[model samples]
Target: MKNEIRVIGGRFRSRKLRFPDAPGLRPTPDRVRETLFNWLRNDIEGARCLDLYAGSGALGFEAASRGASKVVQVEQDAAVCRALERNRALLNAEAVEIVQVEVRRFLAGEGQPFDLVFLDPPFRQGLVVPCCGALEENGWLSSSAKIYLEAEREFRLDGLPLNWRPLRGGKAGEVGYHLCERTFFR
Candidate 1:
């Protein structure tokens, strides 16, 4: 079976993207995305972005539609990657790149700093801390980057980098979303 999600803002607003139904594949909801982008209005234009665990490529595509210079979507699943590719073609998203690799493996390679990152790993996998650490330690973030995190409402931000200052947060039912800014780098 396949599921569909809509891009809620930017040039691709109202476009429908289809994806295969897979375990742990949850696309960020429309309202949540709207709020996140609103919070990033001043920062997103022409920014470089990384979308880890890119499941349905919702956030990444939205960023591209909104004028991000480049958007890398990292997904471990081949089927999902194919769907993302199709969507990229459908939207003529020249700035979006789909990387078919595990998030950690991708993060382990030489890093290119990104101005914004979306880290929405599978729920209940305890991946947030390690991935967050890899992103910082591996130098995948620009000095003043902003990161968007989505997880279960009960999930805490303990163990995250001390410089990741929370800028905004909100909740919708079982999910909690936050935007954090990476402060001065050593």
Candidate 2:
């Protein structure tokens, strides 16, 4: 199995995390994360983020490490939430908020929009498109929001909304990733 890496440019560059054992929770790989953050470098600083399916809080912590002002992490699993909390504490990530709740309910309850959002739900649950729709429907995304998605390589949605342009996409190992930005998300 491959290993995870800390943020390339951040406060916690080499800290280690005891992320979930793979085959159960699939964390985004270091290389893919590096590329994603590179693409997001300009937007991430001081941005508010929403991290759904926040296993291990890797992406959320990375956001905080890279200077995101606030990050809200939503996870349904209790164990994962506890681990995420611990990881955040380890990194002194006061800016990271941990919410132990299902992604759907969380979206339905959101009162604020985010600047950056990361969606890395489990492969088979099929939560990405619906989540995006919910965000759009509830104004949980700013007019200029950006979303980074990672899914099983073969995954595809039937009717992805056209609010954003598909800026970049590719397969990182077995995961197909998407990075898109909103143009007129009204």
Candidate 3:
């Protein structure tokens, strides 16, 4: 059976999205998303966003609903990417783009800096540090970009870029969610 989730706010509020059963495809919980966006209220509008490891495309689509100028959702699984495409079409999300690729490979290539980023990789695989390093080293972040990261509640976000400063964070159940902004002058 397919799993379903709803958009929490903005133009897509209450809209349901369906996705095939795929491993590690958990969508960000609605309450957590609401809090994350609240932390980003001032920065979300008109921002360009990147949703790395775009499971369920929740963060990317939410940014589009809230008026982000552009959003790129990168996911490796073919079925997951198709679901993301379906949701984008369903929402008429012209500002959003879905890419079927490995997150690290995408980051290795030339990057167009984004104003906001959602970096919610799968939990408990040592992905956070390497991905964070790639984003900072490969020119994927605009100066002063805001990044949202989600991981296992016990995961320690060590070895991240020095310039990325934690602005807000909280834990809900087993998930630890955080918002960080890239500082221009470290």
Candidate 4:
């Protein structure tokens, strides 16, 4: 199916992004994205972001549009990666980078710490916890960095990183979205 998702705010407000009909590649809904960005308004400008499991480039592009200095989008599907590249070119999004690699492999490699991260892997694949762990253990996150995680509504937060503190979260139909802060203890 040919489907498109829109950017709800910032420089690219109302921009439509098209994605291939790939299985389990649901983009975060517009309303949810609006809320997520609202939660991130204060911290987003000039921040570095990582969009793990970036299915449709929704969150990554939104972050870039809203003034993020750098946004890295990681997706394993070549087709999706191509689409992401197209979107990046369309927007002349110099700050957005696409990495066509599995999330696991990308996390295993070295990377700079990000101020914000979006994790919306496929539902029911048991990826959230491990991805969160990889971001923490692999030094992909900065201190007190904000992380936005989307999953099945029933998914639990107990498995997330110990230093992560839930800041804002709610369920939207079958989807659950949350904003957490990575805390640092003295």
Q: Give the clashing pairs for model 4.
A: none
In model 4, which range of ten residues has the least summed lDDT? 1-10
lDDT of the structure predicted as candidate 3: 0.89
Q: Which is superior by lDDT, 1 or 3?
A: 1
Question: Across residues 1-186, which tens digit of lDDT does each residue of candidate 1 receive?
Answer: 349999988999899999988889988988899999999999989999999999999999999999999999999999999999999999999999999999999999999999999999999899999999999999999999999999998988889999999999989988899999999895
What is each predicted model's overall lDDT from 0 to 1?
Answer: 0.94, 0.83, 0.89, 0.92
- Stretches of model 4 off by over 4 angstroms after superposition: none
Deviation from native of the Cα of residue 7 in model 4, angstroms:
1.0
Instruction: Give the alpha carbon lDDT tens digit for every residue of 1-186 in model 2.
Output: 443446555887878777655344878888888889889989988999999888867788889999999999989888778788888888888999999888899889745989999999889777888888888888888889998988899877445677777888888778999998878946
From the highest lDDT down, the ranking of the candidates is: 1, 4, 3, 2
| Model 4, span 1-186: residue lDDT tens | 458988888898888888898889998988898889988999999999999999999999999999999999999999999999999999899999999999999999986799999999999999999999988988899987999999999998988888999999999999999999999832
Best prediction by lDDT: 1
Candidate 2, clashing residue pairs?
Answer: none
Quote model 3's TM-score: 0.96
Clashes by residue pair, model 1: none
Lowest-scoring 10 consecutive residues by lDDT in candidate 2? 1-10
Clashing pairs in 3: none
Per-prediction TM-score: 0.98, 0.93, 0.96, 0.97
Best model per TM-score: 1
Off by over 4 Å in 2: 1-5, 21-24
Q: What is the C-alpha RMSD of each candidate to the true structure, in Å?
A: 1.1, 1.8, 1.3, 1.2
